[model samples]
Target: MSSQPPEPPPPNPTTAHGSDRKLRADARRNRERVLRTAQQLFATEGLGVSLDEIARRAGVGPGTVHRHFPAKEALYLAVATDQIRQLVAEAEALAASSDPAALFTLLSAMMASGAENVAVKSALVAAEFDLRTAAPDVAADLTRHVADLLDRAHAAGTVRSDLTVEEVMALVAGAFAAIRHIGAETSRDRSAHIAQLILDGLRPHPR
Candidate 1:
């Protein structure tokens, strides 16, 4: 008796597409892991940390990091841009909230984030990579979120009446510079205090 092997099942496009999507999702996650690890290392270990070290810390292969970033500058830009995207997400959440003090909360987070990543930001600046120019869409999205929060604060009388979104953005940049200037970037308490002073200045003054 000739026993013919069972016919192979027909290819399923749906299953193939699902597998492709999963692969893309995994790649996105790996890239994000590299970005976060690079960001922490750059901030704590300075910009001298190697990509291989970042891969080891991120639990990915060196090849993966290289495949995604290619160079330190690319990783630097990705880290900085990732930080801003996180802030934009936070701002979006705050915008959805009914809390009147969301603006201050969001601002505090922004300052803390900037202080934490001051090293990376400085490295990018040294490399002449302005995030506003490099990642304009994400940068603009964050700015828009800040503007929305500022408007809400104005209506709620939470922030100063004279304050504008540009000034608020400038204050964040200034906070980063001040954190770097006093070498408080590594000192959470000191950097926070500086941010607090800046935030306090944004409050409505009692006549």
Candidate 2:
């Protein structure tokens, strides 16, 4: 018999959607686990910590880590990217209030996170991960907010006129290391102590 128009391929719309949704969910969970594990290990062990270790700790296969991050640099950038985004958001939010203490308050919070912050920042710098290249928008946003906060505080006579955001970042990095070595039992105590010291240094003195 003459063949009629061939039947179209069977539609599996519901099955396709279900499979895709489940896949997306699994991917998201895997990525989050990898990121969390990476953050912890990188902070604790520096950038030299292997991807294998991260994958193992995350309870995923090496293939999974690679699936999420094509390369180690990408993973490192992702971590720093998240950090910079947070820092930018914090600066912008605090700047909105124009509270003279906002800049110092932000510094307190940064130091409060302890040397993990320092180590991560250090690793990124050491790895030469270009913030502008990897996450230009967030990096530029962070820079802008930082400049805004420092300039405003300086103009208001709340902060030293000669002080710069560069100085503040460097100072916090140093202070974080010191507090880590101090080995305080409580982060609250450590944070407060570091915060006060930083604030003291940032205070405007009579010329």
Candidate with best lDDT = 1
Please give the clash total of every predicted structure, in order: 0, 0
Task: Give the clash total for candidate 2.
Answer: 0
Candidate 1 C-alpha lDDT tens digits along 1-207: 899999999989999999999999999999999988888888788888899999999999999999998988899889989999999999888988999889899999999999999988888899999999999999999999889888988999888999999999999999999999999988999999999999999999988
- Give all candidate RMSDs, comma-separated: 2.8, 4.4
Note the Cα lDDT for every prediction shown: 0.92, 0.76
RMSD of 1: 2.8
lDDT of 1: 0.92
Distance (Å) between predicted and true CA of 110, model 2?
Answer: 3.4
Q: Which stretches of candidate 2 lie over 4 Å from their true place?
A: 4-6, 9-29, 45-49, 59-61, 112-114, 169-196
Instruction: For candidate 2, list the clashing residue pairs, or say none.
Output: none
Cα TM-score of candidate 1? 0.92
